[model samples]
Target chain A: MKLSDLLETAREDAPAARYTVDDVVAAGRRRKRRRNTGWAIAALLAVFAVIGLPQLIARPAAPPATPPPPKAGPFDLLFSSYRSGDLRVGDPEWVSLTNQLASIGREVSPGVYRSVGRLVLYPAGSVPQTFWMSHPKEPAGAINGHEASFMPLGRSALIKADTLLTWRNADGSMVLMASFENRLSREEMVRLATAFRTTSPRPARLPFAISWVPSTMRLVAVDVSRPEAATALVTPDRPDIGFELEPLYEQAQFVSAWSEPGLNSAPQPIGLSFPRSTPGNASAPSGGIVIGVQRSFVSGTGPTPKCAPWSGQHNVRQCVAAPDASSNLVARAGHDVPQADLERVAAAGRIVGTPGDPEAWPTARESFPASAWVER
Target chain B: MSDKEAEFREFVGGQMEALRGLAYLTCGDWQLAEDAVLGALARLYGKWGRVENPQAYARSAVVRAAIDETRRPWWRREQSHGDAMPDIVARDEILNIDDRVHLRQALLRVPVKHRAVLVLRFLEGLSVPQTAAALRCPEGTVKAYTSRGLDTLRRILGADLSIDERLEARHEAV
Candidate 1:
């Protein structure tokens, strides 16, 4: 038989598929939900970590509580599904940043720079819902006779860039919907909030671990769904330092740790030393340190690590390539951190479990040494 | 249903069988092939609205995912239907069945990259450039793998394989 005939016949006896289109759609929806929430949570965390949270801690008090509306429309379907069009609706994913909630959004354009209309659902008795319930709310008209309260706030009351619509569900759950960049009108925000639905809650996961951390730092934010990154910001010692953590290995295998100056202080360390990533006309952050692990294939076993400086701009990072060349671990310390101490921190890192299996990797909370974590 | 979802369903319904067949050939086991296709399709579903040509995306993704499945440690994959070579038996009266079994064995014997090249070039009717694009390799590398794969098959089959080499030659000429 000809080669084509042989190839065709070889695949003929394969069994029927074990999954259906619906199964694929369902999985897709879950992934989309997880990924969307992951990005928003990461952004919120980045803001708090990099910019500092003194303003949040200094709130005088929430204004007097507003009475609940007499009636509200059913919003059960909004969380369970998606909306498409000029204002494309996204799936809801669980948020565990400060409180347990399911966060969802609708966007005008699905790009990084585009504004997303935000909706956060807090379960009854959650800290955020209770705190929000204590605050006075502005009447923003009604949605199908259900009274809605509007607040001019962004992710939180501290950043007042967005217009927020708040209300209570029949189940005593609290819903806060914000129109980012004023992309959605007050009426649109009310309508979206009224039509909102709920889906299964999905919690994010951390990709890497840290066995040691300085006493002054704490993990303030994490984005686990898509890029799988976390940030631990330093407090008290100096408000300017923070660590950016992510998985470095291909296919999200090896977890890594990076450090930089405060968000408002300077360009991120990665952008400085790596020209390909350099932000426009940005200067390197001074008095900052960075540590990361990079995965690469090298022939042979038990090769000693070779540590050296990078050839790129800023000329920072003392890197130690693994003996097998399977990975490269680097420590870049500015004047703030002693070089020896930075090396000690870098030395504490070791890849755990089977390299490629994500399940085998330790949880972000589990990956770090107990001493490394500081509760706020 | 949203048009995005309906479109994805139609695409999946139409392409599911062909993709399964492609994946099975790429990875030598049915179970691994199925897993690879499902994983690829699940990811594709998330990007359904954005991906301009999902068939091309699914084809490349399935092929690569199948390759990745093969890279899993042998002991781990042993729980599944492993790719252990079968013993050669005497030629039977059922010539088609015997030839198919023999052909499968021979195909597995070829190196994975070369085997992938052969599958893409022959079964999928992809030209050297198209195979190169699918496999993300140079066209010259595709030609070389095709030659090496054909040689391996010829040595095992113990026959001069009669297949059109004209497509490769024609593309090379262009």
Candidate 2:
């Protein structure tokens, strides 16, 4: 019999599915309750952190004889500020920055702030601008002594000439000021950069942070299944397109998740083929697809890597290894968002807070609040 | 309940049977397929409003869950009904029934992903692009899987009936 005939027979002979609508509705309600419980626990934790209840509950025995290994970086002092949750939306410092930038645009939405990150969007006429700040990978260099980088947004050339200005605070925190309208002058940007200040450190919770966000998108939802695996969803103001930032446990997982399926089901001979050639050097093996390469990492072991990221239409996944080599961060986008933008955003993923604590990151629902969206 | 909940329930009711069938084709076991479908439906219910294409998303989730189920240690230990192939029928007595049983047995032997591609492309009648979106893989991969899955099924069915002959007959019938 023909393949189509067999498939048709299978479909026709399939057993009757036995499930009631009530069964599904009950399951959904249970899921909602569990999700709400998770949020409640997170909120309680935030309250406890704010009230210093952990200290009051259990006073620690006095100091160690050895001075704690000198804090790793100058930013260590700023960790307390992050922990205190003092950098949140209503903080005087953030309020002052918002007020100072009011001339350019009004705050159209409530800001989303974590211990080490802050995101606030402003609408100026047809353009959507954002004020974002987070701890930098390293101390940011000064742009004319103001600790900022001002350059044209490099993702697209046809898109209007938009500029991005990012600067560092005294405590090693970095702020990103970008204008989609291409109207912010360098002098005005520098003046705005000077207004940021280092507030007192407080205990705060921030699950994860991304170094770069696309001009048209805002951080929406973050779902942390575990510390090593978190998914951040981003949607544009207009809701035409959205994407996710997914953290896989290892490079192998990233490769398997992204790899393209081969042309045949039978295992193809293990080899490499370059489908897309590199731009400059014809001989340089770049941009071509790699097929069935075995990954040698502590966490990966299997035949035929199944989840590697390969090029695809509509969806593009770009993965980069974390600095510690413990995990891979993948940025995935669909529906009109360019690959260059995804790669830049993926490259900018930064892990803040304790690496493995599930509580450090916000749940999916909490990350994207109703107030976060600003209608066009 | 709420309007959103009612909407989600209606969607689940409409899509459940098809998704369950898809899951069964992928896993080759009724009980496991049910579990996968239920798990996927529960997750879909949670994100009903947020998901752009609930049907496509549900299909992907079911496929992933089915694949995940096969990886579990218990999956190998479980004795599915397909584990024991039915008694072979006489050559002409019940040829159609025999073919169906043999087809199912052959499908059980096929790899998880190849089986998934076949079920989605042919059984569900999803376009290459739609199948790719459902599987969250490249379209090229789906095309390849389709070719390979059919080839595997052809090999398992018999050497007497060439794939060319079957295709010619199918085309003539159409």
Candidate 3:
């Protein structure tokens, strides 16, 4: 066969595309928005450096407010179910564990979930939709006499190799064991894979509740580090204005987008009393609204419950600081929605449980608006 | 859909498959190839009207994206559950499937850069200058890579595929 014919044949049996054209358009809009936002931030920083910083420096420095009592770290709830002190949940160094972008794994044991790196557990049977890159599989000998294999979990330009071992548990659930920093050898990985077991599915919970969202928006994706961290991306049904709905998630330092597949279609019904038009959002279309809510870990001395316009070029955003300043709720809309309405939605953000107690936290269904719950 | 969106959809419909094939040849992984195409096409969608030659831009972008996919952190790589052989050509072949599979395996053994050059020149049938433009490398580098890539393939297949000498001489004299 001609080399060209062989090349054509190689791509002949590709699986059906997992994403739709609309998803592509939506992602493009988001990328464009992110680029625009990055430029805007750069410009704002330049202005701040040129004009804003000098005035601040020239002013008398106020004494730092007495620090509020140290609060629980954002990931405290992730370890809520584990009664044992043996498993360290979130260490300063483990921050790399949360950067998988979109990864999910099942709970292997109580307080011991096996996700990308962090032990944060995902609901059983959930699979990642977008595998960011292709991993070429290689053979690793059997583990515990059951068929087993391992794949290098590093990028093409790998510096420290990570390996992922997979084997079938007698219970039929696949057990995935990953090594971090190349610390575990092939034998150690196999041993862990052989020993690990997955427990029955447990629902993930959140530390905060969003009692309201704009009527038109729906929950699309969620990134949660159980017990302490959670963020959800909620946008309208329209695909055309996805750029206007780009996540302001970066506002919260801990959370990232859950790139899980099929999560986008999991929209819950939203009950509505919100008007179609609001004062500051006159130009914002109802279909262009996006709302993001995150459990805040930053401690500030500012007065409770402040709402102000957030940044964006084509959208109006209102970031409402929770009463305890323990969570951040940001509402965004195309240039048409009234800013007051967006504020009202953001201000509805409520901390539903003690920051350090995972058992006290609400399940996603309980915490999110009726429309934002993603049924597993 | 607006006129711009309609135009983009039409372009995607026409070129998506060809782009996928090109990316697969470049990256040697179907999943990664699809990802590269999707990403490149999405970027194309963002610049739909502004890009003067969408076809060329997409071809270059898909190849570049596919290469980048190989460089991404392993943590971001997909985890397959099965113990399948490496590079299992998808299961739709009928005629000379073994030959195609062997050629593909041999082609992958060529270094990624040289392999990219070979695919563009021989498979995509681009001239040395065109391949260099697509790869953002100099013409001489393209020529050298093409020669090195063909030599490697000849060694692996042990087949005298001297047909490219004429093509190379013609381009070298230009």
Best by TM-score: 3
lDDT winner? 1
Instruction: Output the lDDT of residue B108, model 3.
Output: 84
Q: Between candidates 1 and 3, name the one with more favorable TM-score.
A: 3
True contacts kept of each: 0.82, 0.45, 0.45
What TM-score goes with each of the models? 0.39, 0.37, 0.39
Off by over 4 Å in 1: A53-376, B74-78, B81-93, B165-174
Could you tell me which 10 consecutive residues in candidate 3 chain A have the lowest summed lDDT?
A: A244-253
Per-residue C-alpha lDDT of model 2 across residues A22-43, encoded as one tens digit per residue: 8777787798899999999999
DockQ values, each candidate: 0.44, 0.22, 0.24
Give all candidates' CA lDDT scores.
0.56, 0.49, 0.56
lDDT of 2: 0.49
Q: Give the per-residue lDDT of model 3 (tens digit) for B1-174.
A: 799998888788788878888888888887888889888988887799999899989998998898888788989988765535465566655656666677778878888888888778776667888888999999999989988988898899787665455555665675
lDDT of 1 by residue, A1-376 (tens): 4788789988886677788888877877888889899999999998997666766666448743654433321111224434544443443322322332222333323432233444556554433623334456689776545577876643433332356677776555666665656666876666566676544333333334556656543433332322222222222234554322111101101111111112212222232222111112111234443444433332332334344455544545443534233433444544445555556655655544443455665554565556544343
Which has the higher DockQ value, candidate number 1 or candidate number 3? 1
**What DockQ does candidate 3 score?**
0.24
Per-residue lDDT tens digits for candidate 3, residues A339-362, read 665666666766677755767777
